[model samples]
Target: MFASGASRRCFLLIVFLLCAIMSRSGVQGGANLCSVDFEVFGNVQGVCFRMYTEDQAKKLGVSGWVKNTRQGTVVGQVQGPTDKVREMKVWLSKVGSPSSRIDRAVFSNERDIPKLEMRGFGTRY
Candidate 1:
């Protein structure tokens, strides 16, 4: 009976150790994921541009947040598969907010983006 109890305790300890290892590994794996940031310029403000960008991004399965900057530029940081990000850029450039005109767009790789819970999109003061 004592031997059985010892064996059970040892098994539980091993399981606990494995769980810890997996959790740690998962965090490291997530850190390795890549993301990108985009700075969109031109009539990107005051015409529901941010909202439109968010919608397009969501439709493309791109994960990120979009907000208006003080300079009237729409800034967005999208993180996901490279292809999806590119698709979002194309969609935004071609068929974004009808009232807004896009002047320039810059893309760059970023470290990681914090998860955001946005309804549609929003303007930042």
Candidate 2:
């Protein structure tokens, strides 16, 4: 129908305007990308902490790298959607490897990244 063409055009225009508004409002389609660096202290080394962290990060669809520090702690950086990053931080702080005793997790250098700096989660060294 001729009316159908006009209505379709109007709908597309509306959709375009909505997308513009959303982008201008700081929406990145899915969510804002966030990155954070964390160091977990207390009984983290030699406990498969980095392995567990890698698994959890992959499961949460995040990308980052984890490693053991010379000071017997676990250090890592996580980058993903804001909510996913928050969840990862909680897991690092509270629900670390079953064999690991997490005294506390210190997060630093947290910022909103326009894009992810890493691809895929893994253990470093």
Candidate 3:
């Protein structure tokens, strides 16, 4: 039977909280997938940066592709579990190949994805 208004509101509130928790914990379908595009500045090119990026992505269990841009920068897109994607971002922004110098990193098109766009990490050139 339908309860009083207060009781009904409480039940709805509990359901809402449960849904929020599930989504946050990635219990819901595809809630934990994230996608981001990044460009690394500084001496990123000709330093095996793309190779290192692919390696890092694979290590982190993410799927993406990295390539050298004509502007003397490294560009890529990464998609995977939210936490792993975050780690990859940090690696691109701060740490790169042994000989690479990272002056700045720019990220764009960041969004939550329903699924990964790629199967495995790879170099695009």
Write model 1 residue lDDT over 7-42, tens digit each, in one string: 989989998998788766644333233466778888
Superposing all C-alpha atoms, what RMSD in Å does each candidate have to the true structure?
7.1, 4.2, 3.8
Model 1, C-alpha of 66: deviation from truth (Å): 0.6
Q: For residues 1-125, could you state the per-residue lDDT of candidate 3 as single tens digits? A: 55699998988999999999998887888478989999999999888888888888889989989999899998889998889889998999989999999999999999998777779989987
Over 4 Å off, model 3 = 1-28
Off by over 4 Å in 2: 1-30
Estimate the TM-score of every prediction. 0.59, 0.80, 0.77
Worst 10 residues of 2 by lDDT: 22-31
Which residue pairs does candidate 3 place in steric collision?
none
Best of the candidates, lDDT: 2
- Those runs of model 1 whose alpha carbons end farther than 4 Å from true positions after fitting are 1-33, 110-125
Q: Compared with the true structure, what per-residue lDDT tens digits does model 2 show for residues 41-93?
A: 99998888888999999999999999987888889899998889999999999
| CA lDDT for candidate 2 | 0.91
